[model samples]
Target: DSFKSAAGSQTAKVQQVVTSPDGEKRYWFKLEGGQASPGMGDSPEPVDATITQDYETAAAMSKNELSGTAAYMSGKLRVSGDLMKLMQLQGALGQMPTALKGIDVDY
Candidate 1:
């Protein structure tokens, strides 16, 4: 994920917790020396930062319709733990559209 690219030479674990009808769901990825790897389950393997937001907010943020920084400032997004990690990802959030370009989905 671009978040990992934004991590540069740092090592960080960024987790996202989204509210689900049953309760909550979690997704996360880790970055080490600029490489990204996905993680599974509700908790991060070694959480450096966590983002607590609903699916809608996440989607909006991902699509570039909403800014993570603005969302964080407006309470639409919440972050905990090492806020610095989240800060690094802030710019990557804006690149989602660019990243989505030239994609051909067979399905």
Candidate 2:
């Protein structure tokens, strides 16, 4: 996936969660270059789970430089609604595309 910068620089895929439901648990996963669609938010329909985190922090966690549990303890990450659902979702999220490889961003 390509992430097009406002300045016209094309970056790698940076998955961003647009919305998530509260009860039903819905998640939207859009690759940077992928098309945007509606109904991305959480819904009443049952789903595995949903989690939202800062992109940079997620990258760090993905690399094992930080731990989700640790971040939560440090108040670096915030989770709402179902706590167990969030823990269960962690495994699946760790397998997704969390890093924007080869993409240069000004930190």
Candidate 3:
């Protein structure tokens, strides 16, 4: 249940800090392909990692103009979570390809 615990911890952080356009913040990540689904009733809540960037910045990053760490530090991306969990996730994510599906990058 490590994944669940990780997800729960992340959900708590997102709920505490993120908000939607109407001032409501709620989200979840759908784990499809590459990994098994956590199963019904065991999925983690979603979160939005907002990246404040224009098309150019996005395009550049998409083309590998910046590394993930660099993007984060430069304000191209922002994330919220338990620092430990976040770091763990980052390590996992570092093993993934920058691009997923048709998206420029996984972010």
Candidate 4:
């Protein structure tokens, strides 16, 4: 998986929760295998880390109008669990065009 490949041995399950005006959405990534998808529910494996953001903030991240690191620093992004795992994947995460590339944002 792209995430696993990117992090190499740094394996973890990352959950992304988005709260938007329309509704809420969730996604997960198993960094070891780089597996990511939508929907929120129980997982057989444990979640090592989680990132929470509202739709607009996430969209800002995608367009590089804002940054996850900066957002996190400013408390716009909420993080829980294994912060190290997120940090380890920082390089990979930073390359993202948008936090949710599939979703459209006005920018």
Candidate 5:
């Protein structure tokens, strides 16, 4: 609900890179028609924004122990491209906790 509302009519292709001792993992997702669909590896097409961060920072952000805005400001996270578009997806990203609640992560 919130995601859809916040997403509005926005459309974008976003890529994310998380680096850790295990190396780097990349993910791409598309926000279109008020829905977000994620995929592994690189994006099939060009992206509007790319966010890169360490695994710890990403984990912290996922657990709500840290905020994305703070991470970016503190140099823990890096983002490029249409930042405003990415920020607009903040509300959508906020739903991650609930959406990921049932999933079991190794770290």
Candidate 6:
């Protein structure tokens, strides 16, 4: 899958929480040994990092319209734990837009 290829040997468990008017949506992106996948709800395993942002910010990031670093610097995103690990996963994260191409998503 595109996600696996994008992961490319980088290993990390990342918890992403997106807040919206309805509520919060939680997802876990687990990357290991050149493979990666996402799961809904809380991460079963201890995560290397957690990122929380509003729905708009999350959508922007997913669409590649906003960079994580930029979001964090602008106070639109919040990150906790293992900052270096999250920083290292930027390449993998940057692949999100390409990886999700053609998927039908409302937001």
Model 5 stretches astray by more than 4 angstroms: none
Task: Give the lowest summed-lDDT range of ten residues in model 4.
Answer: 33-42
For all predicted structures, in order, the TM-scores are: 0.73, 0.38, 0.39, 0.70, 0.86, 0.88
Q: TM-score for candidate 1, please give it.
A: 0.73
Q: Point out where model 3 deviates above 4 Å.
A: 1-28, 31-58, 98-107
RMSD of each candidate? Answer: 3.8, 11.2, 8.5, 3.7, 1.6, 1.9
Better of 1 and 2 by TM-score: 1
Per-residue lDDT of candidate 5, residues 1-107 (tens digit): 66677677878899999999899999988988878888999999999999999999988987878888899999999998889987887877776555556677777
* Candidate 4 local Cα displacement, residue 31, angstroms: 1.4
Query: What ranking emerges by lDDT with the best candidate at the front?
Result: 6, 5, 4, 1, 2, 3
lDDT (Cα, 0-100) at 101 in candidate 4: 63
Error at 103, model 2, angstroms: 12
**lDDT for residue 21 in candidate 6, whole number 0-100:** 88
TM-score of 3: 0.39
Give candidate 4's TM-score. 0.70
lDDT of 3 by residue, 1-107 (tens): 33333333322212222233444333233433333232222225553332244444444554656655776688765665444544545533333234232444443
Best by TM-score: 6
How much is 102 displaced in model 2, in angstroms? 13
Report the C-alpha displacement of residue 24, candidate 4, in angstroms: 1.7
Clashes of 4: 1
Q: Between 1 and 6, whose TM-score is larger?
A: 6
Best by lDDT: 6
What is candidate 1's CA lDDT for residue 106? 30
Task: Give the winner by TM-score: 3 or 4.
Answer: 4
